[model samples]
Target: MRLLILGTGGMANQHAKHFAAIDGVTLVGGVDVDPKRVEAFNTAHNIPNAFPSLDAALAWGEFDAIANVTPDAIHHPTSMAAIAAGKHVFCEKPLATDYAKAMEMTEAAEKAGVVNMVNLTYRNVAQLQRARQIVQSGEIGKVKHVEASYLQSWLVSKAWGDWRTESQWLWRLSKKHGSNGTLGDIGIHILDFAVYGAGSDIDHVFCRLKTFDKAPGNKIGEYDLDANDSFAMTLELENGALGVVHATRWATGHFNELRLRVYGEKGGVEVQHRHDWSKLLVCSGEDAETGTWKEVAVEPVETNYQRFAKAVAQGKTMEPSFRHAANIQKVLDTAVVTEQDRHEHTV
Candidate 1:
């Protein structure tokens, strides 16, 4: 598979490195609006071709697939172009800025008969994969309740650098800069993490989003710090399970962490992923009666990168598909609507 790194941002490096390491795949080209960034990306990754725009890259048209590491707003247009050119797509999360565009991309990719995938990076966690397996196998019976969260402290800590001064992070806190904030950012992640592990799609959602004041007048230069910094949602799965999903940038002390707890009639399952390590725990049979939770062994799962490459090679689409992502985006969009309309929204 000949792949194009569609954006030359920070995350693009991971895409390039992972795809290049695949035995049958090659990084044939790269695309970006910034000349210096794209050139630096190509030089760092040894990509043979670079283009100033997606149009130029498509005209060159040597690659078989695109690793769309573009910003949240750019995914729709670039992905549509790739699909029109009959190229497979491996897109980053949120699929698009909203559900409508994401659905359009999903439908176009499907109609084009091209393999499509979204990089819901949490899917790569072995514990998440095993938790899904356990739920599907009825080991946890029918999941009745779930609790999930994605927590980060970047706002309070300088771990990844100061968002107050850095345009990269500042734009994320501003709506005009094309950022959906924490809910739009990591919300996709924990939503995918929870719903995927529960083995069900969200049926309805109601949410409350909060924006905290940062700096005086909440103004950091040209960027208005109005985007949500924290959010909480009440959701119902298609299987009639009730759950709460939340994410926040104000979660101090923790750098980054995702945890999911699922409870059912017969048993319970829990998965925790912090930084690099993950673990899956289960309580069932007599252990449930005794109130004991034991760790279950789980093997590593194929990453979204590897899966996208394999799908391209095999002419098939896999989990975390474009459709699934669009559905996830529906939930995310619905949450935003609930905040706007002051009521629960359906997914």
Candidate 2:
């Protein structure tokens, strides 16, 4: 299967690298707004074709699917266009900045009979799958509460080269570019992972989206930095389980840290993935608190690119399908609204 990558940034580059290892998948070309970035990506990744725009790549009609790796703002339009063009799509998370647009994209993809999946990257990890198995198998009994967090320090220091520049992180803080900020970015992952582990959907959310000005002198006169840099939420799951979810890009020492703990009436499990290690620890109710926590082995899971390739080849919709992602979008939508209401009431 031939694929066209729709961006030239970091995630796009990772997609290229991962797809290269898949047996039957080939990355035919790339499309980006910046010609130089496209050229650089092509040169670095050995992609043969680099189109300056999505239309040009779609017109070429040589690829069987699209890897939509564009920014949050562009996710909707690009994925919609690709599905309309009859190409299967593997889109990045947040599906869209707007929930309604995300629903439309999923519906359209289903109507087009295209295999669709979202890059909820943790879903690709074997440890998470093992965690889910523990919960579903009743080793943990009925989940009562869950605590999940995703943290990164990149936004705190603002020293990651061009990443801290106004055109980059500032644009992310802007309402136009990325309204949900850390919540939409990493927070969604926390939600997805927690729900996946509990084997349930989020029933509702009470959330607070907070912005800690990372600018020098803690002020940005130009952009309001309206998007959140951190968030905290209380969630209720469909199966009567309660949860606490938090996400922050300002975590001081943590870089790409994601942690989850699910507590059940009879047992509990904890999964942590960070720069140092990826571990899943479990304990049954019979195991005394003083007893050592058992470390469960994580089996190997296929990468998202490999799974997408196999799903396309087998004519099956991939797990974490567009429909599944839209449910997550709905959860985000509710959180956004609840945050706004809280602000309005405080004002």
Candidate 3:
């Protein structure tokens, strides 16, 4: 499979590295708005072609897939362009930042009969997969509640000023880009994991979001600071399971800590921290009586790009398809709506 990467950002670089490492898959080229970044990535990766825009890259028409790793705002347009060019797409998280655009992208891919995958990488973790298996196997019979949290300390430090001090941060902080910041960025991953693990759909959400130190004594350029730094929400799942989601960029001393706990009639499982070496702890009534918890050693799973490539080669549907991605967007949309309503009614 030939692949064209559509950005030179951090996530795009990560995808490029993983795709290049996969056998039988060729990283054809890359495109970025910044000429220097594009040229540098091409030179570093030994890629023969690098274009300044997606339009230029699409003109080449040699790629079988496009990795849309641009910012949240451009994911829709970039993926649509690639789909129009008859290429499968691997879009980054939050899909399109809203339900309608996300549904449109899903429909376009389905109509074109091409594969569409979203990079909700947390689901690929071996421990999380094992947890899902355990949950579905009646070991955790009839899940009742799930609590998930993803936290980062980046925005809690003085260095947060440096990031917001740039005009480039405007796209991420503004709603016109389709998201309200950390919720759309990291919250989507936790939401996807919640839906995937519990094997249920969220029916409604009640959210409380706060900007905390808005403006933060450090204003940069003329961009409006309208994004939330922290958000918490309660999810009512279709299966009568209650779930809570907490995401923040202002958690001091924490760096990418993603933790989940699920309670069921038979047992419960906990994923302590997903971003690094963490174990899946399972505790049943028997184990609780014994005052012990069963620890499952979790081996890290490989990149989803490899899985995507293999699926394409064998003509199989990648688990958590674009439709599944759309479902995740629906939950996120509900959370956003709840947050907005709360904001409007604030005293």
Top-scoring candidate (TM-score): 1
Runs off by more than 4 Å, candidate 2: 158-166, 216-222, 288-291, 343-347
1-347 per-residue lDDT for model 3 (tens digits): 99888998777778888989999989889899998998898888878888989998888788888888888778888899888888888888878878889999999988987888888888767778888888888887898999999888766564444455554545566555455677777878888778777777787788887776556552335555677778888887787888899998778877678888888987898886634567789998788567477899876676678778876777564866777888777777777777767632110
Which candidate, 1 or 2, has the higher lDDT? 1
Flag the better candidate by TM-score, 1 or 3. 1
Per-residue lDDT tens digits for candidate 1, residues 131-150, read 88889999878889999999
Residues 287-342 of candidate 2 have per-residue lDDT tens digits of 83655578988778987788899999998988888888888888887888888777
lDDT of 3: 0.79
Ranking by TM-score: 1, 2, 3
lDDT for model 1 comes to 0.92
lDDT of 1 at 137: 95
Where model 3 places Cα greater than 4 Å from the true spot, the runs are: 158-171, 174-179, 216-218, 342-347
What overall lDDT goes with each candidate model? 0.92, 0.85, 0.79
* Pairs in clash, predicted candidate 1: none
